[model samples]
Target: MSEIIRFYSVTDDYGEFSNFAEYPVTLKKVRWPTSEHYFQSQKFKDKKDQQEIRKANSPMLAARMGRDRKRKLRRDWESAKVNVMREAVFAKFTQHEELRELLLSTGDAKIVEHTENDDYWGDGGDGRGKNMLGRVLMDVRQALRDDA
Candidate 1:
C-alpha cells in the first residue's frame, strides 16, 4: 500500500531494514484506542458537588477549584490513556512485517536501545517519568540485546 510508512527509530538503530513498512511511525502509530469522550472530564475526575460549593469562599471559587481539579485530572488521565494506547500500539506492531521478520531472522541480537524521540514513551531516566510504551519496548529490546 502506498500509504505505508516506516519508523526510522528501529531502522536507524538496526540499519538496513528489509521487511517492514513505516506507516505506523507516520500516523497509524496511535489508533487512539479510545473514544473522543474518553479524554473528557466526565471520563476522568469526579463531578463537583454543588452543595459543597456553597460552603466555599464563594460559589464562583468552588467552581474555579472544580475546574482546576478537572484540568489536572484530565492531564493525568491523558498520560495514562496514552500509556495504554502505546501498549496496544506495541502489541499491534509486533505483527508488523519488519518486527516479526527481525525476530524470526535474528532471533535475538543487538537490542533496540532508546531513540532520540523515545523520550516521550521512554522512561526518561531511572523510572522517573511515565513511559509505558518505552518500558515495554525497552524490555523487548533488552531481551533481544541479550544473547539467548
Candidate 2:
C-alpha cells in the first residue's frame, strides 16, 4: 500500500538516465554519504585524531565532565531514596485491602484544601506542611501497579 518513486542517476559524461534509468528507489534504500564518513577516510583520520585529543584536553571538557559527575550522583541519591520509601510504605500496608482501596479511591475523590491554621493530623503540630508520607505511599502504589 505504498507508492514508489523512480530515480535516474545524472552523469556529466553521458547526460541523465545513462547510469540508472529502469529502477525504482525508496528513501530507506538510499546510502547517503555524510561528514562522518569523510572524516573516517584515510586522508583525514590523523587530523581527526589530533583534533579529538585537543578537545579532550580543553577546559570545556573538564567543566562538562564535572557537571556530568554531579548529575549522576544526584540521580543515584534520588533513586535510592525513592526505593527505600517505596519499600517502607509497602511493608506498612501489606495485606491491608481497605487502606489500598482508600488510597486508590483518592483519584476520584474531591481534594479539600485546608487553611494554614487547620490541624488535620491532630498532632498539635503544623498540619500545613507538605505530606511527605502520603506522597511516598502514592509513589509505592504506582510502582506496584507498574510492576503488575
Candidate 3:
C-alpha cells in the first residue's frame, strides 16, 4: 500500500456555488519510488528541456529566469510550513470549546499551552511555534461557545 497526498486547484469564481460544484483533481502520486526521484527523473528533464528552449532565445533572460525560479521555490516551501502549522492550530482549537474561550479571553497563551504537548511547539523535535494564527482562531471559537 502507498500513501498519497491529493491536491486540487480551483478555477471557478462563483464563491459558494463554485466550491460546491468543484471537482477534486489529483495532481501527482507518490509510490514505492520516492516523489523526489520521480520528479528529478521525468519532471526535471521536462523542465530542463523547456528552460533550454527559452534560454536559446535570450541568455540574459534565462539568467534572470533562474533567479526567479529559485525565489519561487523558497517562497513555496515557507508557505507550506506556515500552512501546516495553521491547520494544526485550527484542528486543536476546533476540537474543544474551552480551549477556544481561553484563547479569546487571555490570548495565545492558552493555545500555546496546548501546542506544547506536540513537538511542533518547540518542546519536541517539530519547529512550529505555540502562538500560530490557527490556534488563536480555535481559542476564539471556544470563547464564543462558552459564553453561549
5-87, model 1: which lDDT tens digit per residue? 12223346443231122323222343222211112222234434322332344323543544555344544655576654444
**Distance (Å) between predicted and true CA of 118, model 3?**
15
Candidate 2's TM-score: 0.28
Cα lDDT tens digits for candidate 2, 11-126: 32211111111112111232212211211121122444323322333323422433343222333444354444344345433334554554454552222222242232111133
lDDT of 3 by residue, 49-106 (tens): 3334233333234334433443333334444644433433443344445534443544
Q: For each candidate, what TM-score against the reference?
A: 0.32, 0.28, 0.26
Q: Which stretches of candidate 2 lie over 4 Å from their true place?
A: 1-83, 108-130
Candidate 2, run of 10 with poorest lDDT: 14-23
Look at candidate 3 and tell me the lDDT of residue 85.
37
Ranking by TM-score: 1, 2, 3
lDDT of 1: 0.37
Lowest-sum lDDT 10-residue window in model 3: 14-23
